[model samples]
Target: MVLDDLGSSLRGTLKKIANAVHVDSKLIKEVVRDIQRALLQADVNVKLVLDLSKKIEKRALQEKPPAGMSNREHVIHIVYDELVNILGGSRELPIKKQIIMMTGLYGQGKTTSCGKIATYFKKKGLRPALIAGDVHRPAAYEQLKQIAEQVKVPFYGDNKEKNAVKVVKDGLNKFKRSSDVIIVDTSGRHKLEDDLIQEMKDIFKATKPDEKLLVIDAAVGQQAGSQAKAFNDTVNITGIVLTKMDGTAKGGGALSAAAEVGAPIVFIGTGEHAGDFEKFDPARFISRLLGMGDIKSLLEKAEESMKGKDAEKTARRLMSGKFTLHDMYDQMDMLSGMGPLSKVAEMLPGGFSGKIKDIDMDDTQNKLQRFRVIMNSMTDEEMNDPSIIRASRVKRIAHGAGVENRNVKELLKYYNMTKRMMKGLSGNRKMRKNLMKQLQFGK
Candidate 1:
């Protein structure tokens, strides 16, 4: 979950509202104060925080709840909308032939972001190429070269060439004919020095990039605004890419600061992994942050992660009430590929996701792994038909997997429960129809 602490705090405050005996002026003020503390602690700008709180308070007090909504629900809605506005809305970058120039100070994860952004485009069915334009740093060329290979995209760089502008020009020419999207990882400095500005100017003039993105570290807090303005002044920055968003308390500061500069946060790097990059959509971001869930993004992740897998076949098997451990293993693998369970949970509706958060995710993940291991120790007969896994077989399987016999029993119990549920769903016409439509199974 990105901004884990802030999300938890906000959810706690909202829970207070949900549990309140009555919705009144006093309750509204208390909720407003709680929100103020949460936003301030998350490093949001003081003025921005105050302004947001005031708007929320005014709306909650002055406005009437909708016909279907209660006062508490209406107040929560106001908070969600205001938070989204402060974070700024999504910036659309079309998938087409264009050059993107990435710039930022050194240690802002700019180089790695080039790779992640390239992966993002590649996943979108676009051909993206990487250009190593950071000439001041000796390792930038090799690092980006490795990243290009990792993403299986064409790369251009002249490590011996000290002229950053010339490197970009040559690289653009090299990949211009073949690549759909060319991303140039420009040079950075220790500070916004004169030479850095001049080099960036030269590169900007040379490439005529369609998008000038400034990568900012979310941990920079309020200072990110100054950095964003400085870079924007230098290159007329078209967008911002926030890195290190996961688990950062100061992410709110970076987000709001970037928004204040009027450069939309086009993307965010959530973690160290190459797959951790995501398009920044303020409404969806705040939705997840407030535990409202972004079903759209969740479905998108599922479609992307489950690619090449036989979802239709699995759906048919499930509908036929023939779900075996083998089928369950495949399902688990698909879930794991989608990313961590915590992240997926964050995309679920508040009511359900909150319950999931109570269970230790680490323990659950380990248990999933343990279940897979236990299944691996079973014979095809046992895996396909768990009814044959008697007491003696359980002990032997547990010993093979280096686990207690009870672990095997637990796996069997879980499997039986899942199988029974599948059987029930298979028999329900309306539920089955909806499930198939949602899964797009057997399409």
Candidate 2:
């Protein structure tokens, strides 16, 4: 939910059109005003917001609806397209061998992003390696080494070395032969300092990186533009990596950071998990933020998260009214393992994602964890046939789970809710048929 405020507010603003019989000048003005307020509140640059709003207003008023499109649809298309252009365009990291030099201010998550970038490339069948050239930060080498381990990629660093330059040179020679891409993590400063800038320049000259990415934290808000400009001037950065986009109201600024330097945000870090990183696409991102959903990213995540898991078996069991608590626990594990719930929720269509806003995700996620604990305490027979559990069994389970009896009741309530919903949906043969075709479990 990057720029969560804008998502909820903008969607609401757009929904105002649904009640209207026509997309008139008055409706267009109202929508534009709402868009301005949403973007400004999200910490987007005031001038930029005004410009974008103006363009949206002009286009909505002037552009005729294309064939088979209604006036409302035309206006929506104008806003969507304009927003995409303001944010970014179709830009990508090189597919060929590359050396990526990561540079940013202190505490910008550059180190973690290095691992993310490496993992992204490795997943694309490239032999990737991480080079720890940030000799300034204490334990920087160790931190990146652990990340490289987590991502299952090769790492080269010299913890004992004092000169960051020497570290980069050695790491480069070590990884040059074996790796397809060598991502170098450089030093950072609390503020832009002469020494830090010079260090980055030296790293740039030494590595001759294909992409010098400035990893800016999304919380920096509209100030991100200035930071992007400074970094680009120093090392001539080629792209941006806006990190910690999830849960940040100021994500709008980070999304626009590249606009200041004529660079593109190449990737975005949605969550802290290694698997949470995504290749940023302006069109898909704008679509998701506006509650239109991103089917491509959704399908990609599904394939990744469900890999080697028995999805076919689960689907059959669910349709058969046999998805027991044990199966529920397994399903929870799969979802939790995929990434954060908010990220998964955004991939759902507008109709469903809108409803999810009413849910307290934190509470729901906590309940999910509690459910796991309660299920862990349950016996195999009890989990398989929850209907057999009586009051005494519930109390015993609560005691074993170290939770209140009421909490156990809540878990049961959730389990039953899920059961009913699944049964209701499974009852529709056409629904089952469509879902099976989409999942293509055997195919």
Candidate 3:
């Protein structure tokens, strides 16, 4: 759900393309104008927006639709490609034995991103250590230390020592023997101060980091280009990290500006949680933005939420229409691990993300939690076979779960509805196969 406004606008424009009778010059111009308006509203640079509009218009009018592809599909394809290009082509930070130094102005979530990057590499099977090089702010040292503890990674820092270069030098020696990936969280200023530049250069010299990432807040708008350039001039930034991308309407400006400055966005922080950060994949991002869905990312989230064997077992049980309340509880657990329901819905195909915008996701999550509590209050027999739950039992469950009787009944109703739906799916072989294909089960 990052840049939801822009996504909604773009999806609206694409919807018109789908509804058009023919892909003529008039329709192409209209679509281009719509895109330009959306990008401008999202704070994209005027020049970049105009250039992108021109490319999309030209491709739509001049490029012939491939064999078996319709004009509408061709136009959509061009839009997707150009959008990806402006957002910068896909680039992922290598997950290997290396050192990465993080830089940025203060309040850009640089220290926090250090922990997120460590979590990312750690989840990728690398042993990562966090080094707190922000010697100027005592709070930053404590913050990174806490984040390191929260992520359960090795941390090195010296709150008493004022020299950040020495801290990085010592931390590298301390963790290099045990860790594969060492991440240094450098100090930042309110603006690009000379002292901050000197500190960055000194740390760069000491660590000789494999990657120098500049973190910028998406709310900074087009100013991010100048900021990225300043940091790149000092320490030669290898990539960029855009934080608070989900909260800002100016995310388009930040993305395009960073790309224009020649810094590939290697990672983006979609939400505050460490798990909410993800590698920047321009194609998948544009696909989600256009409401085309990102099945690959959805599958990756599923795989990350649960082990392969457990996922396959659950998938088979659900497809076979033989799951119990215990299975349902496990399902809820997996869904919770996959982050917010809205984010998961974004990856669903067929413009489903647009429809999901209408649902109250927080209420849905609360209801699921209530269901879990109600199931927890039930006995094993009652869970395995809901048929035995009479009025007295429902009353007991409601009382035990600290809810009204209607809540228990509602849970029961939902369970029955789900079972019936799964039963219907099990009866349809083709539909079941397609569903499994989308889920990437057993693949």
Candidate 4:
């Protein structure tokens, strides 16, 4: 949830403007100032912010409002457009049979990102193979192998081979027939050293990758720009993969850096799992940043994580108010693929702040871990029919899940309460409409 503060703050500023009847000089100044403040605080590039504000001001003051559109709506549209423009437009990764090379500093999650990238392509029906060219770290090869197994993608790496260039060259020839996408995971340096940069250049020459992606940790904040510059100087990076965005407040910084470097973000890592990677969508991302709803993006994330017909059926049930404990369990299983509850909550249309305004969502990782354990302890019949779980069964299930009997009962109680609530809300058309709209648009 990088740049998370921008949404609420910008909304507050816009709300003040909406209260005004006319867009005068004073109102324009106030709006511009508010936007500037929010952007700066969110760690957006200062020059970019100034240019965006100028465009927004120019448009708001000079451009004629569309017929039937109020001044407020007109102003909001201009602001949204400007923000999206600065955030960059939709750019999709090419899915053709080509080699993709990953570059970054050590410990920036490049190794993990390579596996995720391979998995992403694999999910698109392309057979991808990962070549572990990173020979610096002793465990790098094994890590790639483990991730490859988890993602079920083919892998080629030799722990015994010290020469990364030779390994990649050999891997390219060996896996050429079977793999459509060859991702060469190059070595990284703890800092920008000449030797490491030269090594990456050598690997590039050997592999001749189609795309060079710089994997950067979102937590690097302002340094992200400098790091991008350093890597860009050595290797021509076509795109970026921002990793660990879920835990970083400086995701905005990394994104701004990508924008500054003229590199579009291709994918983002929200969690540690192989399936937790998501394609970067500018419109949905800008909407999320502005605290406007990003229902489309949220749904896309859900679909990517869940995969296949089960995700579709669950989404249909959610829309139809048929969400039961059984449905909740199914949703939970999908959520596991998506990432942590906190990360998923942040990606929702209204972001985490709006969604959890009234409810005390227990988003602690330990809580989710416990819930997962409890679900595993349940029999298939029990999962579908919670009412069958009596006191004795609860105790046994609690022991199986490694929690107290009270926790098991509490989960069932919550599930039952949620089911009843959904049932009651299902009967009211107006309420359902409002709920759907809220879920869809965060309105």
Stretches of model 4 off by over 4 angstroms after superposition: 17-23, 291-443
TM-score of each: 0.66, 0.65, 0.66, 0.63
lDDT of 3 by residue, 232-301 (tens): 8767789999999988999999989998888789999987877879789888888988877543333345
306: Cα error in model 1, Å: 42
State the TM-score for model 3: 0.66
lDDT of 1 by residue, 267-374 (tens): 999988789988999998898888865333333454444353445555556566787887777566543443323443443446645655544555665778889889
Q: RMSD for each model, in Å, please?
A: 23.2, 24.2, 23.3, 24.0
The backbone clash count of each candidate, in order, is 0, 0, 0, 0
Residue pairs clashing in model 3 are none
Candidate 3, run of 10 with poorest lDDT: 294-303
| lDDT score of residue 54 within candidate 2 | 93
Which is the leading candidate under lDDT? 3
The candidates, ranked best first by lDDT, are 3, 1, 2, 4
lDDT tens per residue, model 2, 1-443: 66677888877776665434556899999999999988888888888899999999998988766644545556777888988988866678977798999999988989999988888898889999999998876689899999999999999988889899999999999988999999999888898899998898887888888888999988887778889888877778888899888858889876875665677888989888787788989998888888755333333454454454445555556656668888787567444443223443454446645655545565676678888889888999999888888899999999999999988887786667556545754677775665555556543
Give the alpha carbon lDDT tens digit for every residue of 1-443 in model 4. Answer: 55556677887776665555455767988899999988887777788889989999999888856644545567777888888787665568887899999998888888889888888888889999999898988898999999889888888999998999999999999999999999998788889898988898888888888899999998886678888887787787888888998877667767776767777888889888887788998787877766555433333454344354454444346546556555675466554444323342343445434644333365534554577679878888888778899999999999998999888876776566445554655566675556545444323
Candidate 1 is scored at a TM of: 0.66
